[model samples]
Target: MPTAAGHRAITTASMLTAEGGLELRPRLSEIPAHVGVIMDGNGRWAASRGLPRIEGHRRGLEALRETVRAAIDFGLDYLTVYSFSMENWNRPIEEVTDLMGLLKRFIRNDLKDLHKAGVKVRVIGARDNLKPDIRALLVEAEDMTRANTGLTLIVAFNYGSRQEIAAAARALAEDVLAGRVKASDIDETLLAQRLDTAGLPDPDLIIRTSGEQRLSNFLMWQAAYSEFVFLPMHWPDFDRRAFASALHVFSERERRFGGVTARGQADKVKS
Candidate 1:
């Protein structure tokens, strides 16, 4: 074994080496390459402050912008945020209308900015559920940012993981009926490739703000072994520091993938 001074010298040399070319910041080990965020607490945030829920939604959108930027800065590849859900339609029609309007406005304002920032924006859900104008805008925004390569910002609109899975099932059934594929060959990989996030990687982390511990129908099929971080703070209040803290938590754990370990690794496990 090397002596203490000799080990220090080797460590110093490794840090000084340009073997990995160059990086602006020290490498962050175990950073979540794919992060799923359940953007919650807009209504509660508004009610807590005696503000309109629409205002809360508005603030939430701005916060999402910051989140997108933060994820890019942290070198996250896929950032999926639950923007709208099928259950959200149960809310008041006026509030729903405003939410749809907010969606349109976000598309109009941020689509260009996202494209410019090299972020790929994708709307994952049933486009047919939206109004004509909103659908058109969603289509336009999706097309504009489709070719981008930096970050994949998936906005789940009118989305639910159960619905997504059901849709996939229907698709598979159709293919089977048409004699295009065998029913027995329908495995997880085949199903995954048919989902809306076909070409994307599975999420490594699923974060929920507003102290919620539930999945709320967000990526249920994909989050099988994902690491979760819950925050009591609302979505509008969750910032970069919170994101960094989650990364730090993720980095500190060992991801053994259900393997048996020796004496040096019994305290923590992450996936």
Candidate 2:
């Protein structure tokens, strides 16, 4: 297996084609620094196979393991996965209990391997009402890998974009009331600093599996400028190849960030 340093070296060397033209195809060096995934369709995947929904969720966990390996091999800096959402509490009690069990199992089984690989673990989301055991597991995962310098695996479990944003706003309001900050001084940067994702770079690309075409309450504020790639396959079917395909699509896009590109600028002048 290539070390992360070896991957970086390969990416640097392949930035251009032999003819000195721009490399059009996806390059390892061009992979986004941060990628977010909305893991969806686990139930659908299980249903298609005439299996229990929990079975699909189990397979999805395996896919997540594969994704983490690929991210490290590709030299990605951050990979944020939407593991569970605040809305998921509405699920049947048995299904919810199963999901919680899976979470505990994943942490217990994978934490050591992840730590050995120098991956830092960070869990984002509301945790105030979680069961004691589950909360402890989350803390353990983050604490065990806090000092690793390689890929940061951010799990958005029990998270919701609206709730996150609202909490940030409420915190800011409290500060203002206490005179720690003034209402007039708050801005996008100030508000973002209070978010669960503070100190993290905004995701450069967001991928959704299961043919989903919307944000579905994940990262609303942070994804303002992020490019999206929706895949037709279920979350259980996502592999390194599917991941690479998303990167290829992102590489071919012209991200203007709401500003005009050079080509567009020239066209505007001509007009």
Name model 1 segments beyond 4 Å from true.
1-30, 261-271
TM-score of each: 0.85, 0.90
lDDT of all predictions, in order shown?
0.79, 0.88
lDDT of 1 by residue, 64-147 (tens): 988888888777778999998999999999999999888888888888889999998888988776779988998898898888
Residue 94 lDDT (model 2): 97
Q: How many residue pairs collide in each prediction?
A: 0, 0
Predicted structure 1: clash tally: 0
Best-fitting candidate, scored by lDDT: 2
Which parts of model 2 have CA positions greater than 4 angstroms off?
A: 1-26, 269-271
Q: Write the per-residue lDDT of candidate 2 for residues 169-232, one digit (tens) a residue.
A: 9999999999999999999999999999999988888999999899999999999888899999
RMSD of each: 8.3, 6.3
